[model samples]
Target: MTVAVGAPFRTVRELWPIAWPVILSGLVALFINGNDAFLLVGSSDKVLASAVAASAVQFVAAMVVTGLVGSSQVLISRAIGSGRRDRAARRADAGLWLGMWGGTGAGVLLVFAGPVLLWLLSGPAIDGDFARAYLTVTVAALPFVGLGSALRARLAGLAQARGLLFASIAAAAVDVAVAVVLNHMIGPFGVAIGTVAGSIANALVLAWFAVRRLPAPTGVRAPRATAVFGVSRGDLRDLLALGWPEAILYGASSGAAVVVAWLLSDGPAADLAASRILELTTSSIAWIVLTGIGTAATTLLGRSLGGGDLPAFRRILRHTLIVTLSVAAGIVVLGLLLYIPILGLFAPSSVREASVPVVWLAFAQVPLMALHVPVTAAVRAMKDTRTPMIASLIAEYAVFLPLGWVLTRVIVLGLTGVFIAHVVFWVVSVLIVGIRLIGRIRTPHTLV
Candidate 1:
């Protein structure tokens, strides 16, 4: 899973290989999630309402380990760039150990604490009982999601992202098939169980390939790769240092959706439904697609920096930014054009009225998102996740939520105000993150 980072990919051909698989995989993963909506279309608004909460809940909880294990990608890429495959192996080992244990703990906490957590996160957006049932059944998926993230990080670092795509396809297929079968037998909870099944399938497939293709290090002189938890304290610390901010960043993003639901709870039910549907669909597309681009940026920049190739990093960043912005623009246009039709297909008949008007705000976010996703990725690649995390906190708490509260609650502008605030949050975030990214790019390797 280690490849030397020599020259930057100079041609469009080289760039396509890194970007396409990750993008396709993101799309495939979306299909797995898309099942919750597509299959449950006939369900009531209460069940439909659970969609946002369930999605946010899984992401928020899973993000804890996902962010930590994600450090494996950073560390592994750097090691490969510097021609230290053994170090990459250690990083991968650390990721797996932490992902397993951390994922388990998160799952246990969420399952046991389901009622309270769902109460806060779901707000009045979803039926409390339905949310709990969904959350409880999907508890087992958390660990698999964590491990799958770790495995994905390694393949991404090694630039073998096609493996990740294969996993995603398998996961999506399993999810759809199981969901269909179980829905007939068991009713609404089928989708939740199917989600869990997909997670396991994804992790298992990734593990199978990893074991056979990415062999264990031999004739190596690091401590046995198996300590009590399979990695050394140093590697653990390294992961935490890089990962905590990623956790915070992702958690904040996920938690923001829940917060939005809470804000919309007191308003007209249609508004909340519209917002949630937009979040699960339109907004999800922007974030997911940008995430694929961000992955490419991370791998290229992480490896380039590790190899002490500043020029390569610069070029890679530029290429990433151009492609991300271009793709995001296309996504925004297509999403806007197809919003009503897509919503009609994906959501029940109840949501169309409130959704059509506010969906523009969701689409408006793509430009800002296109800006920050790669800029922040570049910052993270430089091993300074704190800056982006701090920026997100400032934007989310200081600006986004507070401004949203005022616009919606104090001013009574409803969903209009909420989406406006959402757009503004990214504007503020892009400025903050861009400044840090530029600084790090100029300095190279210096955390400051």
Candidate 2:
């Protein structure tokens, strides 16, 4: 199903097929991550804190893997768009090898360094042992996380969104079942184990689907010696060149969240719990949509650039901004309407009450986030990742963190201060990226 290069509206219509599956898959993935928090709700507050803290560390590590996988998507999409299927296949294969090795290194590091990291972030309030135990299982599963991310990127680059949906649903089902059964049998630690199992299942299913869908390698090379395990020097260089900025982007953002969590450690228990629930609810919803829209932008714009259809690329960018903003506005309204009830479902009364203002403040940032997603995605699809990375770094470190600290600590605005800083950061991000995107679109610089 080749997209029409001329008809922008028709391209928007075509996006639904791609976008819906990606959205559903992303939501399911969120569910898989949030399952532990959800299932551990009725447990003690310390247990819940431990679970959230453990998951936070794991989330940062997973984002690092995602940074690497995102580069594979860009390369694969462009290769296929330029009618270089063999190149796409090789890139995908290289991505898989990178994932395996990267995950192994991450897993080993987490096993050794995770406890100290959790200790610093969680402090003395949460159960350090419980957090460490959960972190150990989840971090050890990084290999599977890496593999799944690479496979999903390959499928997404091929425009096979349905495959990702299938893999995500299967993983979510496994996560739910294991979390429920194991939590009953083994307490909170069971949730972490379930997550690990789900990661492995997700990776295996996606790997099988990717193998079936991706083009077979050319020539008579042995399966073992062929693209299945092939890793070239050029592939490594390209991946790193495109991927390192993304790693910094994700790592910095997650690191900021860790800082916030650590700051909240000295506050009330309800505030800590509220922050987690807010993450699980409002933030999760926004990220799911953003991720889906960003994936679509990458695939469509990468293809357009590969075909040398600058007009189509620009049109795609415009359509993505319109559709994503429209969707984000709708989500913002819905979140506002359902804010109390949504928090009510997952959190106790004290936590829910404390979280309401934070959720509302977060909702206010949605439109700005909507504006930022497509612009950054367009830049990254052009293989100019550094611009967005720099923009994000400035927003996170320069604007958000310091402002949040001043508001929360200096002025004593509590959670509201942190979320206010959140809104300001998005505002800054939108302006910086918007300016860069406008310059790129107008000046007609060559995409690297």
Candidate 3:
């Protein structure tokens, strides 16, 4: 069954059509999530301040869950590809249980240790107090985020992208509406509570759908917090075996971002502000391209691996590279054309003076950023998690951080240098990871 490149329904083409909606849905969600900050900036100064603090806490919580429970995407995606529906169900159960325990642990730590965490990071006593209040409310909402991410990954693994997209859109709409009304009525604290409430609503909707869509067994009671979700011991072991490396990969990447943030925080006000602006822009685009391609890659490559078709798996990898390049070029061109307008949306006056170059430099790497996602994702699909983790770790620490340090500290380019460093980092990342992925695809493995 050799599929032609121009075939109408080939796996590669099929993923493209599905991926566009998923990517667009994710971008809309990001925009909606940022709505509170956007809308409240003009309301009251206090409301604006609170929105900033709360958004930080919410993002930190999201990063924690995203780095940890995101492994479910790879685990469940591979399980479905293997045609092990029973095992897939069990993996979902284990993931749910894991998310619960992980969320509980993090929530407890935030309750007890959050103040100290904020104090250490805030750079001043007054700032620490504000950060603490925000962290308090946001931490209280962690379980919902954790649970929702796990369920969403399960749904994605099932290839029910439309359902996931719809639920996400609904959730985003409710979040923005509720946050806006509350921000005007009850002030910034109201906005924070409204945001949490919205996430709770999203979780409830997804939980209902997940329960309905998931397979049921005759006599099994849902497992306890430790063992609940109907996951067996064997399934738990397998998921961890596959998921831990992916978790570390995400954690390392996020941790690097935080370090870079801290480094920039010590610079001049313009430098700090410029770095933050660059981050927001890069993050917005990165989530769309990386996350969409990663999900699509896991599904397609996992299926090929499960069907024992190495050639098919190889073809998917090559197609992913081609798709990445195409998307990357489009993003770069868009960035170049809209640099002034897009940067103006965030910091109109200062953008041209300080942030535009950084933003555009980050944009220039969109293709390289695209290369990173699908390649790493294909490795996960092949159950070769160690390779990606190792490669990403090397790229982040040995390549990204070191060069960024020199560019920002030693070089005279300031913010521009930081942006240049970002591009260089991604270029190096693509080369290293891309080569490794190519090697894996070329060397076939037998699954006896």
Off by over 4 Å in 2: 1-8, 213-230
**Best-performing candidate as measured by lDDT:** 2
Model 1 Cα lDDT, one tens digit per residue, 43-91: 7666666765666677678776787678778888888888898788788
lDDT of 2: 0.80
Of 2 and 3, the candidate ahead on TM-score is 2
Q: What TM-score should be assigned to candidate 1?
A: 0.91
Error of 1 at 192 (Å): 1.1
- Pick out the ten consecutive residues of candidate 3 with the lowest summed lDDT: 215-224
The true-versus-predicted C-alpha distance at residue 378 of model 2, in Å, is 0.6
lDDT to native, each model: 0.78, 0.80, 0.64
Sorted on TM-score, best first, the list reads 2, 1, 3
> How does candidate 1 score on lDDT?
0.78
Q: Sum up the clashes in candidate 1.
A: 0
**What C-alpha RMSD separates each model from the true structure?**
4.3, 3.2, 4.0
Candidate with best TM-score: 2
Minimum summed lDDT over a 10-residue window in model 2 is located at 216-225
Q: Rank by lDDT, descending?
A: 2, 1, 3
